[model samples]
Target chain A: MDKMVYNFSAGPAMLPVEVMQQAQAEFRDFNGLGVSVMELSHRGADYMAVAAQAEQDLRDLLQVPDNYKVLFLQGGGRGQFAAVALNLMGKNAKADYIVTGQWSQSAVAEAEKVGQVRVLDGFETTGNGPRALADRWDLDPTAAYVHYCPNETVEGIEYHFVPDTGEVPLIADMSSTILSRPIDVSKFGLIYAGAQKNIGPSGLAVVIVREDLLQQACPHTPAIMDYAAMAKADSMLNTPPTYAWYLAGLVFKWLKREGGLEAMGERNKAKAELLYNYVDASDFYSNNVHPQARSWMNIPFQLKDDALNDAFLKEAKAEGLLALKGHRIVGGMRASLYNAMPIEGVQALVAFMDRFAKQHG
Target chain B: MDKMVYNFSAGPAMLPVEVMQQAQAEFRDFNGLGVSVMELSHRGADYMAVAAQAEQDLRDLLQVPDNYKVLFLQGGGRGQFAAVALNLMGKNAKADYIVTGQWSQSAVAEAEKVGQVRVLDGFETTGNGPRALADRWDLDPTAAYVHYCPNETVEGIEYHFVPDTGEVPLIADMSSTILSRPIDVSKFGLIYAGAQKNIGPSGLAVVIVREDLLQQACPHTPAIMDYAAMAKADSMLNTPPTYAWYLAGLVFKWLKREGGLEAMGERNKAKAELLYNYVDASDFYSNNVHPQARSWMNIPFQLKDDALNDAFLKEAKAEGLLALKGHRIVGGMRASLYNAMPIEGVQALVAFMDRFAKQHG
Candidate 1:
């Protein structure tokens, strides 16, 4: 029998086991149609039902307002960095970006290509060694939008509270934190998440945008990237990533069956806390981010001795804990406890770390 | 026993039975790692092998020259419409588009937004009702590139020969017809195909661009859409459609096992001939495409009586022949014989068409 395995990749991360099983079972024959759901045309009734249900389920899970448009688009979070700028910066041609970490910093680079961008620091070094989220930023009342990364996947930094940008539309790149918990959908003007993490799979991004913000896209914006055009067509402006969208629907159904985002939020919190608690208690393993700012989804922890990093990863892989290596820029280990990751996986990682620590210590 | 099923959806269409079965068997535990391939990180060695192998196999299949870069990207064929214009128009800021059908016309619209566009009619009305491919176009030598859709999926039109554009790069959107037959890769400056039809799933697009054409992308082009940036990163500028890319790799392997594009071309020709010959022999059903310009991939046929359309579709579905309805713009039925479609399926379709005609006649 195969041993239990846990994947801890930051994005293109794990999906619910139930969702994966259902998708596998129906990989070839969907709804007794004897054809793979992926084989169905996007415009056809069969695939359309799947697409609409996925969107509706996502809406229900998030409690999205009727005035908002949930777009299942191609390109990941990076694509949205440019798309957001092109779509919203047409009239105003300027925005304020909160530079939190690698992701928000990348957003600024893309936004600068289109129009004026003012970068605001998202964090400040506390009196202690760890960094904390900045509570306030200089206001840009006339800006088109205030874009920020609610959860930075690379650095494992996240904001617990939504930054208020009164009168200015607040946009969050929720690629890592989305669906891990419920948020007040009406609070933000737009929220975009790459489907690799807390959603379904790669090749699909979910954009929840207020209806009023859909207009004023630059004329030169690619139709595929134009939010207004995509919103009007219900995100089928072109052939969407159909199979990913279908798999996303299965994931949504699974989420609904597991008592929606409320249940998922509670479960995700418990999972994140299990690892963070273990790391805090152990001198052998340490997470550098401030307790309040540490990500609930991606938890980056380092061993006390950097020399043992290779051995730790090797030993962990032998025990079926995969993809624990952190981003090269911040080397150590990252255990991404996305919505799909059960607490058991975190427990296993903690157990492995304890075993490794004692042998090395 | 379950009846045999044949799917004829134009895109997100039928995949090889062998590939689908293999993928299904291993969907949950890729490479015996006990995790789906979709869950694998693009940066990881496992998935990078998969990505690289797919590109290599595609290169091998096409005999692509060393001077070109093969990029697996997001945003489908329509995304490429904008990408092509944005990438190529930076230097010259103008291009000639040979408008063949709906697809090429749509390309013109996207290109017009990016730069100056000249639409050259791709077809001339023949003495008969059918349209023939125009031999000569008012060429623009100073233009950066000349773009055309080799196969129009909606209208079932195809170019039998490559157009000569002296000193200017020629770009072809082979979304519907790519990998169905072999072609000279060296002839064109760039060739892109949306994966839904002849490749794998919907989200991925395969772009083969000459290295020389990569550098001229507009300053504001999204990094995800910029060929030079994507090429440099090996199409990993951001999280790619990992699962779709894996599936495409499986497809490439399957194509190689099936004796590459040479074998696929012969089989496709036979499949096209079978359907076209059957339609030509029948008075009750007719194909409007000129013989010389008929698409080898998508064949649109009309019944003598439009009243029988719904009945025909219903009856076809009952027999496990699915998605035969044509694009709304072109009424009737479209049978897309992509590479994954076997000769037996075409034979089954012809047999069904014969049975439907006699009963309705």
Candidate 2:
């Protein structure tokens, strides 16, 4: 057997080993169709069944309510940044944005092209560090919707609590943190996650939106980006990313077999704690994100001797731990432990970190 | 070895067996990397090399001029419909379309959503049959571009000659016919094809656009859809459909091994002639498409007795000649002889057709 390395790259991150194996087995033939799933026609019965079951499994896993529609869309998170503005900022033409980190700031930039955006809160920093979420946020009650990124992968910050937005719809870009834990599905108006992170591959995006919000899409919204049109066509407005969708379905099945999101949350929390606790205790390494707001999926840390960053990454890679290097914007190390990453992978990473720190110190 | 079946899907169509096997071999690991290519960071040197090489191979295979940019975009053909309008239509605010069938009609509809669309010609049939391309067309010299589908997958009609569009840029949706033949790159302003048909998978669309036309994209174009932005970013303005792009690179290499587009065109012409000639000579079978305009990639035919349609499809599936049923809009049968479909597959199909007709007739 080939040596398996633990990959910690942030989006397009790790997928379950079982999912990969099953995918390889079915790479040539899917369910005796005599053709790879990638070659199956999008409109045919076989592929349609795969698409439908994927949506149903996702719905079941999330316990999504009846009034919401789960759409398997294309264009990734970036496309949806523009799409969300076009679809939801209709006649109102105004939306409130809460800027937390790199992703939310990027969201604000894209949304600004389409409408009047009110930055309810900017990334303010206190004397200690980045300002807490509790800082006063000037939200506009009449805004079309409230938008924010639930988890910022680059800054390694996540919202541990859902903001209370009573009547105005709440939209969250859950790209990095989706499926890492179970949350109340009814709390948000819409949740969009690019599949590459927690879901499956690059090209597919999963959007869950309340049905009533569908009709508000602007007239100029591209057919593929319009929520109403996509919902009506069952996200078959065009040929979807069939192979990615199939892989995502396999992942959903794997999630179910591992006892769904609640069980997954427990496993994920334990894994995050194992690494974070180790870093917190070590004088040589540290993470700046407030402990309460630190993400369970992505953990970014800095070594005391900044020069050792390259050497540490090189050593970790040599030990069969890969892609642990942090984002260029936030230099050091970032270990993204998505749904597919096991407790053992985290354990291996922690052991490697301890050895690297001692040798360098 | 597993039973290899002939897949006749019009899009998300057959890929070469060697490509599939190579992909499977690298599914667990790529170039000795512990992670799958899908799991690799798009910004990393390893993946960037993959992206750059894929573009180079595509350019080499197509002889795409330096003045033209090849963008590996997401959102399929449908997204490009809206994008083409948003990007190409400037102050003129108008474009001409030659609607041959479903795809062109759809394109015209999408373009109409963004600006003024003039139907230069429609799919009109006289007592003899569908009107020829040489027939009178109301040309709009001042229009931004003249858009047409070089090959209509549903109608099984293809352009035997490029239209004479003087100064107006000519855009062709070559979704079902790309890479099946050689063509003059300088003849058109843009050629966009959804990768599923003759390229790779469904989610990716390859757009080869002239550099001069890049500057004309409207200010309101979504950054992801903007040709200029994508060109500047090397199609990495955002995380691309990496897996699909990688698969497409493998395809470009395979095309080179099979003697590039010139050799592909020759083989394609012979394969098309073999099936069309057989159909024309058979008293029990007929193809409505004009012989001169019939597509080399997709050949749609009908039985004299329509009652045998179900039986034909059922028996074909049993023979491992799958997805032989024609599109619902244009019913009967369609055998898509994409580059991946060997002459042997066509021979098997032809032999089966002869047997089916003999038994029923």
Candidate 3:
């Protein structure tokens, strides 16, 4: 066994080993610049190269249209929740939010502060069980935009269908779901993802917004959160999350080398299937979420015998698996299989689970 | 000369070599935890240690009073401009701003979005000249707070005296000035600094706000931007910039080991004086700012002959002194001497300036 364990955190989850190694080597000096990437100015040639390439790579990966402005922002997923509302809400504006999970609820609530918010109640959460189909969404016609999250980290629910809001724009918080599956950027007016999971680190938030949406910020919008100002400044309205941008750029390159999103989606799907299949086959363990709504990124399952919860976690840690304990909001074990987690890691996890289950059962 | 060049960019400045080395060593694996700090969940025990220690060290360095809360936030320094107004402008309906330079102007513009803005204009063009002092400032009593930046990074202007606002809380954006000198925490109601310059990376913004100022956030503040939410969540309202926070902790240790703020202040003073004295003595180079208001952190100077600017920059690069090229807004060379820049780097810059001046003259 390796000296260190495999960590399965939800958001700030595992990073690519090769990427981490490269980052480690470049921590003191970057491209003969004689200083760490973090130590370079945001506007300098060195960091500008880092920023430019990152945006290009992301655009290429997502096939982001020319009509969209790619923005690198801060304040994580939560910060973007506020930014989206402040930037999109205009005079006499209202937004329609599809309440799929925690993030969507937060977004709708935050938007209500700046403008009117109408929850669509799109996906139903039955004791964190199977989620409703996206076609069942009840969107408001008066909305400036319809907001939803493609994937919910804690509830492990993902939308299989996209809502057609007609002329109204679609905004998605793809913090957990980005890069894990193929996405149609043209379908959404705006899409923002925190960089902690599939991209790189926690500091940078990436926003892909259609050009038309950029001009409608509420008069009271903060300049940093103003989409138009950010697009005008090339996302350097202030000193950006430089190091995070650099790292995400590297992750983008890695994604390109690994055959882009289609390939990533297949691999992620396979990994999730492997883990979920194992859990389903065993009478000792069961996944609570409906299979159709199940997320490929986060696999949340609970042991049939509740008494083994502590023992399961303790033994899992002892066996070199770490952070498998589910989120406090949902009690059980959650194995978040992000892009970085190879198929082999899932196999290993399944093997460990099988052995532990056979003994505990 | 040392193998590495001195970085003099205003922001995303040099970090301590020890901290860099430590980061490099621990980049792939943090404290034998097997995953990089960037890969850990912000709420995890290990990362919480990083957050706690970073805040504690900052408190120790500032000798912050118990009533103040030091928050680690995102959106760079510019983001804080909006967050401050969003959180602090509730008590009264307006905020008073003392405009010193471009950054202060940005702050005033942002605060105008949330509440009424009272602009204190004299300092922008002439207050920090040879005849000015901080005591002569006219402040508003009904204003929520009087905001100012102690140092104008681009203008190379520094405040020698803290403005006394009496019952009106004094809020200063110390993004470019913090950790360069000793500050009495009790003097200001709130102090905020961007981490890129004197602290760590660009993603994290450190805010030191008095306790009494925490509660009056506008009813609908986002969890991440709400000062009370941040204080309660310990700046992990969402996942923080983990690695940046960790690096800051190392910088704090380095500061304490290097004999604390007094020792750092002495070195900074000496470094600034060395450059200023050279500029004053030499006819080839001149700094337009009044001597009393010249900044210790950023020293902006211009060559008498603008034609030599290109040659000066090229020669400076060849001599291993970098980022001497000034901002486009302020057309001249700017040498940012942060805490990490050793005394020898300043000496080398002065010596290079002398050689260049002698040749040009």
Highest lDDT scorer: 1
**Model 3 agreement with the true structure over B243-339: per-residue lDDT tens digits:** 7888888999999999889999999999999999989988889998876788999999999998999999999988889889887888979999999
Model 3 chain B lDDT-worst window of ten = B122-131
Tens-digit per-residue lDDT, B1-361, candidate 2: 3665899999889999889999999997889997788998898888999989999998998899999999999999989999999999888789999998899999988899789998866464333333454457778889999999989999898887888888999999999878999978899999999999888988999999999998887766777898999999999888899999999999998999999999999999999999998999999889988666788989999999989999999999988999988988999999999999999899899999999999998
Off by over 4 Å in 2: A122-135, B122-135
Residue pairs clashing in model 2 are none
Question: Interface RMSD for candidate number 2?
Answer: 1.2
Ten-residue region with minimum lDDT total, candidate 1 chain A: A124-133
**Candidate 3, DockQ score (0 to 1):** 0.70
Model 1, stretches more than 4 Å misplaced? A128-136, B125-133
TM-score of 2: 0.97
- Chain A vs. true chain A, TM-score per model, equals 0.97, 0.97, 0.96
Q: What is the lDDT, from 0 to 100, of the residue B218 in candidate 3?
A: 82
Models sorted by DockQ, best on top:
1, 2, 3
Measured by C-alpha RMSD in angstroms, how accurate is candidate 3?
A: 2.0
Cα deviation of A298, candidate 3, in Å: 0.4
What is the C-alpha local distance difference test score of each model?
A: 0.90, 0.89, 0.85
**DockQ value of candidate 2:** 0.73
lDDT of 3 by residue, A137-214 (tens): 666766788898988888888876676888889999999888887899999999999988888888889999999888
Q: Return the TM-score for each candidate structure.
A: 0.98, 0.97, 0.97
